[model samples]
Target: MPFTPFHMGAGLAAKALAGRHFSVLTFGIAQLAMDIEPLVGMLRDAPVLHGPTHTYLGAVPIACVTAALAPWLCRPLLRRWNQEVRHYRMPWLQESERWSPQVVLASALAGTFSHVLLDSVMHLDIRPWAPWSDTNGLYATISLSALHLLCMAGMAGGALGWVALQWLRSRRAAQRQRHNP
Candidate 1:
């Protein structure tokens, strides 16, 4: 799942559910950070692609570091994203670049943990409980197609839900304005 957009489905779903409590940008950064080890391994031709960083033990530190740094990294990127949204007249896609420390930390944790969980199911080499165990009990727990489908479903459902919420908010605001005017 290295460099794959599949992980974003979960992030989007989380954003839809948690609203202001979840930062999808932070979550995306954490996901990228989690896959760095595997990307390096692939580049170096190492035997173990999914190494320590793909474990629960490994994810904590990565999540913490990502959370600590995400605010700085995300601000400019989010500003650019919002700019594009405004230029495209997609107000519904606009989002606050600023995130609370709590939201950053939670999003980072969620991203790293979910990355590990999703990869564990698809890759045979991922020892998710590593240091304490080398077993991949989650490997192939479900079919590959099913996993992909689930991720896609999450992406679709989340996008629709977010748009629907935005539409409802706008409608209510319009109704209030009409009544007041």
Candidate 2:
């Protein structure tokens, strides 16, 4: 699942559920960070695709690093996105794009942890409890098709939920404006 968009389904779901408490952009960065080891392995044609970085223990450092750097990396991108939204007159997206440190850290942790958990069920080489143990007890917990379908379902549900939330917020704002003005 290296560089796969499927991993983002979980992030989307988290964003929908947690709302302002989760940073989807930071989550995305963490997902990419988690895959770096596998990318390196693929580039070198190494026998083991999932190594230390694919484990639960490995996720901590990556998550922390991602959290630390995400604010710096995502702010400019978000500003650009907001500019585009403003240009297009997308009032539904006009809300502030600022992310707090706590949200960044939480999102990063969620991203890396979820990546490992998802990969654990699909990949044979993912030793989630490495160092203490090399057992891959989670491998093939469900069929590959099932896993893919689950991810797709999450993506769909999360997207719809987020859209619905935005619509409700906009409606409420319109109502308030009509009453006040």
TM-score of 2: 0.94
* Per-residue accuracy of model 2 over 149-168 as CA lDDT, tens digit each: 89888888888887788778
lDDT of 1 by residue, 44-101 (tens): 9988899889999999999999999999999999899889988988776677888889
Could you tell me how far off, in angstroms, the CA of residue 117 lies in candidate 2 after the best superposition? 0.4
**TM-scores vs. true structure, each candidate:** 0.91, 0.94
lDDT minimum window of 10 residues, candidate 2: 90-99
Q: lDDT at 154 for candidate 2? A: 85
Instruction: Point to the candidate with the largest TM-score.
Output: 2
Ten-residue region with minimum lDDT total, candidate 1: 162-171
The most accurate candidate by lDDT is 1
